[model samples]
Each structure stands twice: as C-alpha cells, then as structure tokens.
Target: MITAENLTKRYGAKTAVDDVSFTVRPGQVTGFLGPNGAGKSTTMRMIVGLDRPTSGHTTVGGTDYRHLKAPLREVGVLLDAKAVHTGRSARSHLRAMAATHGIPARRVDEVIELTGLTSVAGKRAGKFSLGMGQRLGIASALLGDPHTLILDEPVNGLDPEGVRWVRQFVRYLAAEGRTVLLSSHLMSEMSQTADQVIVLGRGKVLADAPLSELVRSWTTSQVRVRSPRAAELADRIAGDGVTVTSAGAGLLDVAGLPADRIGDVAAAHGIPLHELTPTTGSLEEAYLALTGESVEYKTKEIA
Candidate 1:
C-alpha cells in the first residue's frame, strides 16, 4: 500500500503541493485527478522520491521510497513515457532497467510480451509511435513485478484497444492484491477503472472518497419529459429554483425538480404526458462540478 501524510512541496515562493494526504490500498485501483497546475505530478514525484517534499512524508509499504532497499521490487512507477534513451532499442531499454535491479532476462522478455511490445522489441525507442512508447514504458514498470504501481496518463496516446487493454491489465494486477495509483484526465475511463478517487485542486486535496460516493454527492439529477403540451407543461411546472428547457419538438429537459414532482404538476394541469425519465449525472459532470472553480485556465464561453 502507499500512503501520503500531509505531504507538501514548494519551489521558491510557490507551493506546488499543499498538505495533501491520501492512502492507496492494495487490491484496489485509486485514481488521482486534478486540473492543470494542480500538483498531481508533483505529488507523484514526491511519492517516488524523484522530488523531495518540503514537509510531511510519503511511504510505500511503511517505508519511504528513498529508504527502500530494493525500490524497484516494491514499487513500479511510469511518470513519463518519453524519459527514455532515444538511442536504445525497446529491448535494450528494458534490459538496462532490469540490470539495475538484477532482474532476470526472462522477466524482461515476459514484460515485453505482456505489454504487447514483443513485435517492436528490437526497434529503436526513437522510432516508436506514441502508443508504442507508452507500451514500452509500461513494460519497464512491470519488469520488476512490483507490488505497487503508479501510472500517470498511461492511456494518453493509446487507441481504444490499447486503452481497454490497460484497463483490464490494471484490474488484473489489483485483483492479485497489488496497489494501483492511476492519474489521468479521462474521467470516463477512470469511472470504469477506479474503485476510489482523490481529487486535487490548486495544490490542496479537494476530495478523497469512493468513486460511487463522489458521483452520488457531487452530481445533480435531472428529468427528461416528452409531451404533446410540452410548452404548456413547462410553463406550469417552472417555479422557484426550477428550470425547464425546450429540448426539441414535444420534449423538455427539466432540472431543479424531480420526475415525480414534474408528473404531479403535469397531471394537475391536465397535460397529456408521453414520457418522463430521470437521468443520473455522469462522472464528467461530477468532476466538472467539483473542480469548476479550481480550473487554473479559464476560457470565455461562446455565446
């Protein structure tokens, strides 16, 4: 398991990560989410000892990363896929990384096959495509067969098939009682892969909870209604704190009111209703609601 206790990082007068604390348990996938400049990468670097924390601490299996005797065997990290030697072949790169940990050549071959890089194993790293590069990085991370995995945007350049493979791979690893900490901008994928989510905004921990809880707590419910007298029904139901929009012919998208309430109002107005369906908010909606104000870069909406 991995744990960060009141972790903080600062550079010069600016603080990159601020008093963040979260635990990543074994046998589950934990997602780390944040906007640009929200310190997600800084926090991951601190966990792997690539960057020093200004205060507090992070531990992998009760020991700090720097203090681990065999760090690669205990924790595997894939922060940047491009942080490899361009002159080396894919096989050479993995072999070199394995050599540092005294890992066997058989293990190197295993990871290459496991990540589906067997065909390009002999190709130069610089000649690989973005998806191929990511696969190589994953192979390197799994070379040591570590108990904990930390991946940052593993699907950044992957196609649908590659992305699905990663999702299944991480789930399989976690099922074997390993710890997985994943960071990505893809909310839809995270919703499917992660059991829990930790959200960071402006260097602070905005939310840390189960994925289901995050969705249930942050999202608002809406009701979709279709009726011949949609406009008349909308006019009758529209009231304090409630909004009804004309979606199309004979269709109204109603918010700030429940389906049953809308039905009651329609029945009272003697309006014939064709359909009334409640819609639950998606992960993207929940994320937007949580990080609405924390977004570092704002764009003017088109009117």
Candidate 2:
C-alpha cells in the first residue's frame, strides 16, 4: 500500500500541494481526480521522491522511495511516458530499467509480453506511436514487478482498445494484491474503473470516499415532467419533501422524490403530462457540481 500524510510542495511563492493526505490500498483501484493544474502531477512526483516534499511524508509500503534498498522493486512509477531516450529501442529501455535493480532479462520479456508490445519491441522508441510509447512505459514500470504502481494519466492518448487493456491491467494487478494509484481528468472513465476516489481542487482534497458515497454526497436523482400547465404542476409538486424547478419550456425538474411517486402524485392531482422520465445524474455532473465554486478558470456556461 502507498500512504501520504499531509504531503505538501512549494516552489517559490506558489503552493502546489497543500497538506494533502490519502492512502492507496492494495487489492483495489484508487483514482486520483482533479482538474488541470490541481497539483496531481506534483503529488505523484513527491511520492516517487523525484521532487522532495516541502513538508509531511509519503511512503511506499513502510519506507520512502529513496530509503528503499531497491527503490524500483518497491514502487514502479510512470510519471511521464516520454521520459525515455529516443534513440534506443523499446527493448533496450526496459533492459536498462531492469539492470538498475539487478532484474533479469527473462523478466524483461515477461513485461513486454504482458504489455502486448512484442511486435514492436525491437523498434526504436522515438518512431513508435503514442499508444506504443505508453505500452513501453508500462513495460518499464512492470520490469521490477513492483507492488505499488503510480501512473499519471496512463491512458492519455490511447485508442478504445488500448483504454480497455489499461482498465483490465489495473484491475488484474490489484487482483494480484498490488496497489495502483492513477490520476486522470476523465470522471466518466473513473466511474467505470475505480473502486474509490480522491477528489482535489486548488491544492486541497475536497472529497475522499467510495465512488457511491461521493455521488450520494454531491448529487441527487431527479424526475422530469412536461405538461401544458407547467407552472401549476410545479407549484403542486413543491410540497413537504420535494423541491421543483423549471427545467425548460413546459418542463419541470423535481427532486427528493422517485419517478413512480411523482407520477402517482401528478395523476392524483389530475395533471396532464407529455413526458415523465427519471433523469439519473452522471459522475461528471456530480464532479462539476462539487467543484463549481472552486474552478480556477470559469467561463460562462455555453448552454
């Protein structure tokens, strides 16, 4: 498992990560989510000891990345997929990473096969596509078969199949009792992939909980009603527990009540409706709602 306690970083006057603390447990996928310039990359760099923290501590297993006798074997990090030398072949890059920790060439072949880069393993890394470069990066990370994996935007430029392969790879690694800490701006993908989430905004944690818990805390399910007498229907629906608002022309959005119950109430009041449908909130919607007031860059809603 990877644990960070009040980890912070500062470069001159700007505070990048401010006392941010969270733990990534083994046997599950924990997503690190934030907007652009939310200090996610800075935090990942601190965890791998590439950037020293200004305060607090970060640990992989029981030791910091620098303190570990074999750092690569303790934690495999892929901060930048393009951090390799361009002239070398993909196989040579993995070979060099393996040699650093005294890992064998047999293990290099294993990671190449595992990452599905066997076909292009002999080609120069600089000539490979973005997808293939990402695969080679993963191959380098898996060279030591480390227990902890920290990848920042692992699926940045992949196709659909590459995305699926990454999703499965993270899950399979966790199933084998390894820790995977991944960060992305894609909330929809996180919803389908992560068991837990750590949400950040402006160098601080906003929410850290299970995915379901975050959804429940941030948003609510609603029912939409469309009728000719929209105002009167909305007024009637706005009683004890339910709150109603105008959604659009001749449409009302009602919350704090299920769709079936709303339908029953509307029918009992002799209300005419052209549509009555349940609208489930998306994870993206919930994320925006939670961080609406905290956006670093706010433009008017185009819609």
In terms of TM-score, the best-performing candidate is 1
State residue 58's C-alpha deviation in candidate 2, in Å.
0.8
Task: Return the lDDT, model 1, position 93.
Answer: 97
Model 1 bad stretches (over 4 Å): 235-242, 260-272
| Tens-digit per-residue lDDT, 1-303, candidate 2 | 888899989999999899999998999999998877788899999888899999999999978888899887878888889999999998899899888889999999999998889999899999989888888887787788889999888888888898888898898999899999988888888788888888888889988898888887788888888998889887776778788989889988989888888777779988888998887777788788877766787777777
Candidate 1 lDDT, 161-277, residue by residue in tens: 999999999999999999999999999999999998999999999999999899889987789999999988988988998988889999999989999989998888889899999
What value does the lDDT take at residue 198 in candidate 2? 88
Q: On a 0 to 100 scale, what is the lDDT of residue 148 in model 2?
A: 91
lDDT of each candidate versus the true structure: 0.93, 0.87
Worst 10 residues of 2 by lDDT: 292-301
Clashing pairs in 1: none
List the candidate 2 regions with Cα displacement exceeding 4 Å: 224-236, 245-252, 266-277, 297-303
